[model samples]
Target: MEPVSLIVLLAMGTLAGAINAAVGSGSLLTLPVLLALGIPPGVAVRTNTIGILFSTFGSVYGYRREIAEEKGNLGPLMAVTAVCATAGALLLLASPGAALDVIVPILIVFALVMVIFQKRITAAIRAGAERRAARRGGAGSPATDGTDPSAAVSPGDDLSSAASIASAPTPARSPYRSPALIGTMGAASIYGGYFTAAQGILYLGVLGTFTGRSMKAVNSVKNLMSLIVNLAAASVYLVAHFVLRVEIVWLATAAIAVGALVGGYFGAHLAKKMPEWLLRGIIVVVALFALVRQVL
Candidate 1:
């Protein structure tokens, strides 16, 4: 382990953690570096997943208050994702990486699309909700009646803006019982447990599109759920390392874990301050870059 490689791993881990907490696809940034360093693919994947568990811890702690508000909604979703993650981890051991190569890019693209179109999609959702209200002779479209200021999110508006949070009374909703939301999360968790790349992107896609929360609020849940998925997968990796004698580059793992922990905590604070549009822009750029790099 040269000093240069150690520095690079630490730097990469820190950046990856921050990106993962603020946006997504942070693991994509680490995998190529690990592979370039001559670590085996299996070991690199396991190391990255295990390291991410610490990242999740730091981010979760940073979002502790928001998570406490959503705790009632989290129990069921956590159970679902953990179980799915276990299944995915077992599948990873049985299957070759080639099987998911194509699907990984597709998932990234889906996440990008969700972020890009989030405003319009949110408008349409609000429109429907307003229409239902109008049928009951309540306030109609915010655009038409102007009775509700918060109902219409302007084109330049960011749902996660500090101004919005201060002036408006928009509380985050989990809808954890929604079948569609559950289905999306279950699938993402499986892929997350198996591949460990771009899983946050997938979570953002589901949370951003369906949760109707500010980007910061959605991010709080994303970090928590991502943590649950990673821990379950890491559990499997640890079991294999001990029982099956699977190898881990412990030095590399230590560097990533320590770096990610610090990075994740700070990244959560960064995300909390970033406007929704900025967060979305970062998500788009990272996901697109990942897509092009993955495909090429």
Candidate 2:
């Protein structure tokens, strides 16, 4: 590759990685650049998929503390996400591109709507959860899902965008069994597997609306889920390249990967440090950008 092209790829990859870690829609930055550089569509797709791993790894490390706290609630969700992502990747070749073009924008619109009305929706979900807990004799409640309530962060942080919820002494939990939460997450994972531009936004909307967790906490889990989905989908792509002769541009992949790693780590670092309001604003802004990008 020429030095100029190499420079461009790395730059795009880094920006995409950071955006993805912060609020998602990072792929929008990289994929188009790859195509513009004259990469074949198939090769660019596979290259971008594989390159995302480095970015995810960086973000995962950046959010390590929050992940450790939420580890118990993460396993089942990650497992389901992995399975869904694998299915999505396997189906990617057979699915019509036009169908995805139409469907994805609609999904983004719904996700944005959910985020916009997050407060009222979450209050209702929490109320419902409390009633269910009362009927079940208090096996689970809003603040405790078989975990220490003291360790929980307030859902209020979700909108206020407080400092890291890790520092907060609020109480709330991301429910493990809310069908809406889990379903949205699963759908996002599948979407991530296919292409992860705005998957983080979808996760934010779901986790934000149903789990009653702070944005930072929800964001930590969102990064983890994104990593898991990408890992699963990347595995499938690697297999296809080895056995089915699917193409990958190794040079482009390397450029994007290196750039993504740097971007993801720092983006996550910045996000973790931001006050609640700023983080919330970023999510809303990025989500809007994603919607516009898809619609156009």
lDDT of all predictions: 0.74, 0.72
Question: What are the RMSDs of all candidates, in order?
Answer: 11.0, 11.3
lDDT of 2: 0.72
Q: Specify the poorest-scoring 10-residue window by lDDT in model 2.
A: 157-166
lDDT of 1 by residue, 1-296 (tens): 78788787787677677877776666766665665676655677788889867888888888899889878887778888999998898887766666546655665565556456755755665566557645756445455665766555666777678476668877756576666678778987988888787778678767765555566668889988899999999999899899988777888888888888887887655654768676566556655654556555
Which residue segments of model 2 deviate by more than 4 Å?
Answer: 96-174, 270-296
> In model 2, how many backbone clashes occur?
3
Residue 257 Cα positional deviation in candidate 2, in Å, after optimal superposition:
0.4
Residue ranges of candidate 1 with Cα displaced over 4 Å: 97-174, 270-296
Q: Residue 263 CA error for candidate 2 (Å)?
A: 1.2
TM-score of each: 0.70, 0.68
- Evaluate residue 234 in candidate 2 and report its C-alpha lDDT on the 0 to 100 scale: 88
